[model samples]
Target chain A: MRKMEFAEAIESALKHAMTNDPDIFLMGEDVHTLRINLLAQFGKERVISTSISESAFLGAGVTAAMAGLRPIIEIMLIDFIGVAIDALLNHASKILTFSGGKWNVPLVVRTSCGGGYGDGGQHEQSLWGWLAHIPGLHVVVPSNPSDAGQLLLSAIESDHPVIYLEHKLLADYWLDYMGTGGRENVSFDVPEKGAIGEVPEKWESLPIGKANILREGDDITLISLGVSVHRCLEAANILSEDEISVEVLDLRWVSPLDKEAIITSVSKTKRVIVVDEDYMRFGLSGEIAAILAEENISPIQFGRVCTEHTIPFNRHLEDNVLPNVNRILALARKFKS
Target chain B: MTLMREKTILELYEAMYTSRYLEKIVTQLWEKGNIYGEMHLGIGEEAIIAGVLSHLIPGDAISTDHRSTPPFVMRGVDIESLLLEFLGHPKGLCSGLGGHMHLFCKELLLTSSGIVGSSGPSAVGFALATKYQKTKNIAVAFFGEGSMNQGMLLESLNLASSLNLPVLFICKDNNWAITTRSNEVTGGVLLDRVRGFGIEAREVDGSDCMAVWQAVETAIPRLRKRNPAPYFIQASCTHNEGHFLGDPLLRFHRSPKKELGAVTGPLTKSVLHYKGGRLDKRISSVSNVLALIAKARAQLSFSNDPIRRLEKTQTHLKDQFAQIKLKVEKKINSISERVLNLVQEEASL
Candidate 1:
């Protein structure tokens, strides 16, 4: 096992996957950041740096994947997905289904999401809920370094289109920038506990639809994913001090959604609090609540702590809008009471 | 002027005739209410499809717009499956889920979509795969001139040129986008627009299959090179059926006096309105409307039909033309009979 940062683990996964498969190629705008590492190692043929044309490049990646080549395309930011949604939503996601299962689009679209960087509205968005709502897409969001590396490999290997979202706060650049006395020496606060972990040296792909039980308890269950999962763990630890046990469930895959794990956890605790970084209305939290209601595993306490349906711009307002440890703890305490 | 072999010319003519006959049958079926939904037929674009696809081998890939039957038929996709798809059969291409607009043939490496300008990106992807595999196979995209204005298509042109991928973009400029004249919405010259991306651009008379064949034949060698670059061909053709089958413009042109009688009173009142503008300006506007209608009528002339043009050129081989027509017609008639029986079987079930 090797201890690596979130970014290093993702790079390790990509390097390993590309070295093993000759058909795998990476294309995106500004992917040349790995020029010395991936471009030099794989050559310009495999590591391509395209212009800022998302629809063209992403759609090209989709068709390339369909034509027997595995293409890993990076969309830079989730906010920019609107420009290329037709390729992902219309082509990549629906190609296999529309082709009567004759063609398979084994394409991976890696994009960064979440807010707190003060990068304005367009740059900061966690729209995984919107992506998961699409039928043929698999949405994977990993909180820790190990899961990030493993889930990405699984996504690359899957015979379907995968939307892999990385939280900007848990990214390597953010952590490295913060460590080096960030801009103006202002330390932007973010959850760092789940950013680094020990990844297995041997390449291993985690199943796409399984949730990890990060913390086991008999009290209320705290369900979340991506950066919010870290906050749930933090809240679980604080609640343990007050003799209140909280189970933290890290939902790794949002689309194939580990419903069995959710039902088991919610059934055991009989009280659940969903902490989501995405919007509150018609979002992940509502989907979870509906699942519970449909399963008739109700007559139990249920609560949610999610971001409002507003864009995050100002640093202070973003912090308030995004779910944090305080919000998880507040909801957990209310469920316990 | 590249001279094609007599055998090759016969093959191209046969393919074009087959497509024309098939689409004509499909139009009849649609008119008789056997086929549902809006049908976009490649009636006048057969010369372009046969000219480009005739040179393609099995491994070569093709991506096309909504009007894809001619290319699909010319590429050797199963005719029964295609006809069954038009009839909405479960065993049809794409299991009838994708109507005439969306068709897929895995063996031929062909795909079609109803979305506008999507063929460009799809062809780029196919060409990228060809480069990765280090093959001589090339990818082709067939779209209308209106699609040239789409951002994705322009972006695809830049990507293909920058990557030096083997992609041939064929723009069939039929002078119209549905009901609107393409020149009014499109800007500048299309050949110049494509040349701006540093790719070689050529134009050809789409009604002349020999001209289109020569253009593609010349481009194939450069595209099959080790370091291949993308190419563009702007083939100007006329859509005989306007945009789709039963287009109102075509209906208006069939009996101009009868169609105009219903609207002449209101049209004159609107054009000569006393409160709107000057009398001279209104009169000039009426003249412009009349000129557009006349142009539309002129485009539907039999001179633009590719089948007649090819037959006219092949007058010396009259016996060969007659033999080819009999074979194509016999094949199409059998296929049509089979499709009708299958529809009957399905209706009973």
Candidate 2:
């Protein structure tokens, strides 16, 4: 039993994979610790860092994936992923099917998302709302340190393009899981938690394309993701006092939409509200509404409380652009009709 | 021209001849309206692909731009499948999904990308993979001289050398990257700059297959291991044809030897009289390969043909198209009556 950090957990997975498989490589920006690069410690032949050409390097990662190498590409900042959408969406997403099922792009795109402290709007956008809309991509967002490590492993081993979004807020968060070297050196064994600090004991891998039902209630279902998930849970607890009994669904994946779970929840609740950290238009909330409409399930009261479409500048504006516990609580009460 | 063992020399000549032949076929297929999308013809350059590829085994991988058929074919790609891909038929390499820019054969470990210089960093990935797997195979990359100007390629070179992965960087210095000369693109002999980054480097006469092979043989073995990075070789080949096939072949340079009165150095005179020679033998074999392609196309008439496989795919795509049907149905009233009737049928029947 030991303690570790989310960044260290990701490093552990990469280090373990690199140690085990010579074909596995680490590339991106600042993958290695300041003084030591990934290649310096793991030998220069295995680890690589590219020059800020996200599209080119991402395409290179796709090219490598198609060429039988499971390449892990680190897109340092999640905000920068917009620059590499062509490589990710057009090429990486289609490689498996494009090869007539004869090939698979076992590629992992690791990037940082969401706001933490003063990173500002350009650096702190959560792409889950956008990427979840893509068909061939598997979007994984880990709310805590432990799950960050486990989900990173799952994405690394996946035969498809897995977008691992590590929120900057959870960056320095400790992985207080069992089976780790908590000494000066980082540890490997972290009890996989779906959320930060402490989660349920039996929580292993919370299955891809399935929403994690954080709270069960018949009144209304608040669907949300990223850092806002914790706030939704808190809001659910607060709403429990009013006996509103809000069902909180942590949409682990965005793109696949977990249509079945969503339909079942929306059908029973009859009132739905989506609290997402992303913008309103064409985002996760919009997609969920579109899906509900597609499935012919029109809830009596429905609304999506999202951050502003504009960029987050300072501390206060950044806070406003992202959802909070009070916001989730306030949004949940509006469906009392 | 015959330097070493007869078999070795013949391999070099055959590889080059096949590169030239297959490249010509791909170009013709594009010109004949068989293939869709942009095709970067390797018509004016053959030695580079044939030269470096001759040393690689099945496990090794190679990366290319649009003009990568030479390495793809010489590395034992299914010519019929390639031609089918060119024809945009179901039997093609990627089942006509990838088209010209995205030619990939996992069996041969050859991948052609639509984006230029994109393959450089990817070459590093495969080489990184091969090194991690502890396999003896290396990753070969063939890019134009202009690609040297791309930061991604340079980054890959640094990454390759940093990891010491088995990666043979073959810069097909054709002197023209879509009309940009080598001088205009790169400052120095690109190989020198590559060496400055701590990667071993060499420059060879790209027109001579043997010369390019000589450089690759030296670099390949060193690359097939980890720790120190693999060496690089720049083969300077001249593009006789335009950027692509129809672009027109620019008259440049002269024949290798002086022409005599009667025989007049056969390469400078009639090429057919030298038929049945090694080069001609391989070029003629391409026709036989094309014959096999025709046989595969003939199978299209049968139910087993790949084109019929679309029926199976239609079921998988039912959902993707289901919305299209509903949208068309919803939009029918907004359009003309005949157009509405043609497009808005609820059922294909």
Candidate 3:
């Protein structure tokens, strides 16, 4: 095992997958800029940098996957996915069913979401719920460096389209450039406790539809994913000092949600609070709530902490809109009462 | 045109005839309500499809738009399964999940979508895969002139040129986007639009099979080179059925008096009303309407059927033409019968 950063883990996974599978290639706008070493190693034929044509490139990636090549496409920002949503929603997501299960698109679309450095509304969004709603898509959000590497490998190996969202704050590049803003009061250090972990040196793949119990307790349960998982852990630690034993569940895959794990955790705790960075309406938190309600596992108290239905901008306003440890703690305290 | 061997010409004619006959049968099926949904037949664009696809070798891939039957037929995709698919049978090509608009054959490397301009990106992707595999295979994209205005298609054109991918973009221009005339909405010359991307662009009479065949024959060698580049062809054809079967335009032309009677009284009242426009302006508007009707009538009378044109050019092979026609009809009839019987059995079950 070796200590690895989140971004380094992603790059290492791509390198290992491409080395093993000759049919795998990478293409997108400015992908060459991020992995110049990949361009050098794989040559220009495999590491293709395309024009600023998201619809064409993404559509091409979908078709290339159908034509017996695995393509890893990058859509610089998750918010820009609207420009090429038809390629994913209509084509990649429906190709298998449309072709009567004859053609399976084995492609990975990796994009960054979340905002802390004031990238504005257009650049900041965690729309995993929007993607998970699609029928044939697999949405995977990894919280730490270890799962980041392993889940990505699993995504590449799957015979369906996978939307892998990486939060900006947990990225290695964002961590390195945190202080570049020169705002002395704004402490932009990596806030997550387990963002960096001992990733296996040899290539490994984590299953796609499983949740991990990050922390164990019985008094109350905090369920979340992506960066919110880290915030929940932080909130759990703070609540522990108040004689509150908090259980934190990190839901790695959002689409094929680990409902069994969620039920097991919520059943054990009997009091649950869901912390989600996505919007409150029609999002992951509501889905979890619906699952619990359907199962008739009525907890003593249930609550939710999610982003408001608004685009995040202005550092203070973005912080207020996004779910932070303070809000998770407050919600946990309310559930505890 | 003379450089093409007689055997090759006969082969092209056979493919064209087969596609035309198959679409005719499909039209009858649709009329009988055996096939459901909108049927967009490649009736008039047969020359463009057969002309180009006849030269395709193994490993070649094709991406096509909604009017994809001719290309798939010419490429030798199983006719029985294709008919079964059109009939919505469980044993169909896509197991009745996808109608005629969406068909795919994994072994043939052929895909078609109802999306207007998706063929561009799909073909570029296939070409990109071929380049990575270091193969001499090429990819062809078949779209209509209406798709030229689509941003994705334009982006695909620029991308193919910039990346030097081996793709052939075939624009089957029937001068119509559904009911609207394409030239009214399109800007500038299409050949110029393609040439602006630094790719070689050509125009061919889609009614003449030999002309399209020769143009593609000259372009294929350049595409097979190590540093392959993209090519574009704008083939001017006609939609013999107007756009889709039972098109109102064709219905109006077929019985003008009956069709226009309902609108004529209201139209005259609007023209005579003083509140709307001046006398001469309204009169000129009526004259423009008359001129459009005349043009439509003229188009209907003209024969741009590629199969008939090819038959006209093959007068010396009258006996061979008769033989080919008989064989094609027999084959189509047998496949249609088998498909209908299977669908009937499935329905009864």
Candidate 4:
């Protein structure tokens, strides 16, 4: 198995799609790093670096998509998405339906999200909930390198707009930098929990709206996504020593959510702990809680571990606000048989 | 001197006449309570629509702002469907989801947004696609002088320039943006500012259809070349009506009629007097100068009207222009009548 970083995997998926199709191009603000030498290789026409005007470029990306070109727009931070929300929410999301299915907005908006590494309130925020709320938008958050590569390909191939959120801390840059405390024994080249795998030579798109069961158990179901899924797995390992068997369900796609997996896992475990890195209110946590409540699933214990409503820039404060491994471990321990 | 071929000028006149007639009908509909919502009218600025659109061939795309009915009509968007859209019918372009403001016809490669400065970047995307696909199809982005100050529009200028995309940025400087004077709100010369981005820029009198056509004709060749760059044209025009229907106030800043009155003094004769000796030229006296001013203003307004702008120069083609106007007027009448019937049917149902 060949190891790959999370960002590398995403780049590989984009590079793979671009190599296969001449119509696909990348446009975004401050795309210098992700672009790397891709600009020199692909030429300026394809790997286009746009000015900081998000709405214009996003609108441009939408029009290009409508004109039979697949455009991937990179918003540096999910927080800055507010600037381009009009284009994303209005044009890209509804053009197909508005045009009576004549025009399909094949757009992929890749954005880095999450509150870690001291990027303040403006730079940090996992607003997948906001994107998920909008119809006609596919929200995908990959938990590991392999899924990141495959799911991005799916997003590119999607006939609708896909809001692909990448968590800051879970990316290979931070994983290689921070080493994730005590998980240092694990190989830093790939993610700690997931096995390292090579991207297929051809573009391989994973089915959207599917969940991955990273760790299987019958006692308690830990439902999470993105970076939170890795934290849940780490919590699962810590709870294993205490004889508390846990199931880790990674929700790969946020919208068209994997409700069947949630229902099946929660039915078997009879105890659930929903973990989300976004603000606890009106977000993924609330959505999961609503699903459980409506499903009439009989469980002895049900809890949710999520970040506090406020996201601070300070390292310690942001750490406390986010649902880290320690918080998930404590939450998982509370779910008794 | 003949500025263009009689057929070409007639085509431009027909497009302008269609726009003016349609806007007039829309204004009447809103007044009669048949149409709802904020409606922007392109009454006096039809020359820019005719001149710029005349340069576009089939396969070329255009993106426009809120005041976009002229382009929609000139681009040959189905009048029945567009009328239905205005009335919020299920079979409208956007299936009644978006009203007149969000008129988008993908088949014709035309898209509009109610938001200011929204269409500029979209035009860039269209240009980018044509360039990448080697389609040689140029895209035109039309916005008001007010939107020129918007950062997105400015960014679009830079993006189109650096990439050397085949795009034509047409800014209709109508002096008034809603109620504010564009000159007061906007800083720096519009042409100079765009030229700073290394884009070829031109400024022309928008009231003169011939001038606009000459400018667009000169600029379009560069855009059609193998390695084309973006072009910018700033057309000076007048917005004769309020920003929207029922806009209680009107700004007469730099009124075209007032200038025409100062230059022409009294209407000894008007071109509208041809065919029949109608509209007797009333001599002005010091006592009746205010009445003369009002009369002179009305005559000048009608004289400088886009349809009549070419009347003096193309006197030989007067009959041809009249025929074109009659045909357009007939089409607009038929379309509006059908729309009214549809609206009544919808109301009854």
Docking quality category of candidate 3 according to DockQ thresholds: incorrect
lDDT string, candidate 1, B81-108, tens digits: 8988776667677665455776788889
Give a tens-digit lDDT track for model 3, residues B1-349. Answer: 3499899889988998899899999988866756543567898898999889987899999999988899888888889888877775666686654557777888999998766688999999999999999999999999998788777899899999999999999999887765445675567988999999999999999999999999999889879899999999999998877666655556568777865774466456545643433466556545544554555554464488787888888888778888999999999999999888877786699
Best by lDDT: 1
RMSD (Cα, Å) for all candidates, in order, is 21.9, 25.7, 22.1, 23.8
Candidate 3 docks with a DockQ of: 0.01
Backbone clashes for every candidate come to 0, 13, 0, 0
The C-alpha local distance difference test score for the whole of candidate 2 amounts to 0.62
Model 1 per-residue lDDT tens digits across residues A1-337:
8888787688778777887888988887545432224553455567676544578789999999988999999887787787689997888888888899999899999888887654444456789999998889999999989998999999999999999998877885633221111122334556676678888988789987999999999989989999888888888889999999989999999989999999999999999998988888898999999999999997879999888856433344557778888888777777777
For every candidate, give the share of true A-B contacts it also has.
0.00, 0.01, 0.00, 0.01
In Å, residue B64's CA in model 3 sits off its true spot by 0.5
DockQ in order: 0.01, 0.01, 0.01, 0.01
The digit string of per-residue lDDT tens for model 2 on B219-328 reads 65566544546778877655545455433112111221321121223222222322222444433433332233233222113232111222243465445344444453
DockQ score for candidate 4: 0.01
Please report how far candidate 4 places residue A150 from its true position, in Å.
Answer: 0.6
As for candidate 3, its clashing pairs are none
Preferred candidate (lDDT higher): 1 or 2: 1
